[model samples]
Target: MNRENAPSTLAADYARAVDDRQFSAMETLMWPEFTQQGPGFSAESRTVFIANLAVLRSFDSTFHLLGQVAGEWQGDQYRGETYCVASHFFQRDGRSLCMDMGIRYQDVIEVRGGEARYLSRDLNVVWQDEREITAPILG
Candidate 1:
């Protein structure tokens, strides 16, 4: 595939893997020494990254993105942006309250031995709900 097509293709596959909670597919894109950060390191480490998928899977409701690409791939690497929104509901204050959050993903992909691997991914906060929400990063 062409350089541009490569990243878009990767993005599509990744979005699906994420929405489906298929964390194993991440191994296909993540390099052993993957170092991901841009404005904020989304996950502390690869292990932490994988662990979050479990949290995601446990959520009662989640709304993750239009699955669009906001960046491009260059040379032997792919770089792009992605988005995801997830929500959870529970009984509180005699009513159901939802916790919602949005993740803006800025990523880098490196192709090795004919496979595209993740070099880095930075996820920034875009939005949050107000019902017992966690502290938001205001930087």
Candidate 2:
């Protein structure tokens, strides 16, 4: 990957990993001291972030990328933003429920030895909704 494009590539890879629930791959993409701050939550370390992701995976959610803004280099780091749409599916009282949310992630990434790593990420939830829906077949 071109040095200038590494951050964008990393962001796309990270989003794919999250959508696929690929924890191990995600681990490789983060710095050991990674931190994340969001609307109502903060992770002080990569461990906590990954653990939180595990919980989210249990909810049977699918994440979709709405768009990604180009990254800008700031000194030795890059900053970027990604917009996402996520839907969580669950069954309660023999009825299906789906919760959808529009989220934005602001990321600060660092490149070391030609590999891009996530240093910090800020998450914002722009909108959300929950509704009852016909249950979709689960494979």
Candidate 3:
């Protein structure tokens, strides 16, 4: 992959890792010092970040759709922002609801030998919409 495309690919890959609940994949995607800061959440290390992801299990499913991904290389690190719409579906109070959040991920990635790994990611939620889901998720 070209150096310029690494940031975009890294962002999408990380989103897939979260949606798939594949914590193991994160080890390869992030540096050991990886930190994640978001609304009501903070993790200082990759281990802590992965451990905290267990909270996602409360939801039946989640889908993170990436929109705009733009960044540039700054010395050895790449800094960028990724816009996303993340939907979390779950049953609450005998009713199914979907929470969709517009999030912007401010990311710093370290590129080595033309490969990229996340150094840090700060999540900024631009907006959110929660509504009941009348349609079936799987059917």
Winner of 2 and 3 under lDDT:
3
Clashes of each: 1, 0, 0
lDDT of 1: 0.65
Give lDDT tens digits, candidate 3, residues 38-72: 99999999999999999999998899998998888
Question: TM-score per candidate, in order?
Answer: 0.66, 0.85, 0.93
Residue pairs of candidate 1 with colliding backbone atoms: 29-118
Q: In candidate 2, what are the lDDT values of residues 28-82, reduced to their tens digit? A: 8889899999877889988999888877766656666657666688866888887
Tell me the alpha-carbon RMSD of every candidate.
Answer: 7.3, 2.0, 1.4
TM-score of model number 3: 0.93
- What stretches of model 3 exceed 4 Å from their correct place? 137-139
Task: For candidate 1, report its TM-score.
Answer: 0.66
Off by over 4 Å in 1: 36-45, 87-97, 130-139
Report the lDDT of model 2 for residue 124: 88
C-alpha lDDT score of every prediction, in listed order: 0.65, 0.79, 0.90
TM-score of 2: 0.85
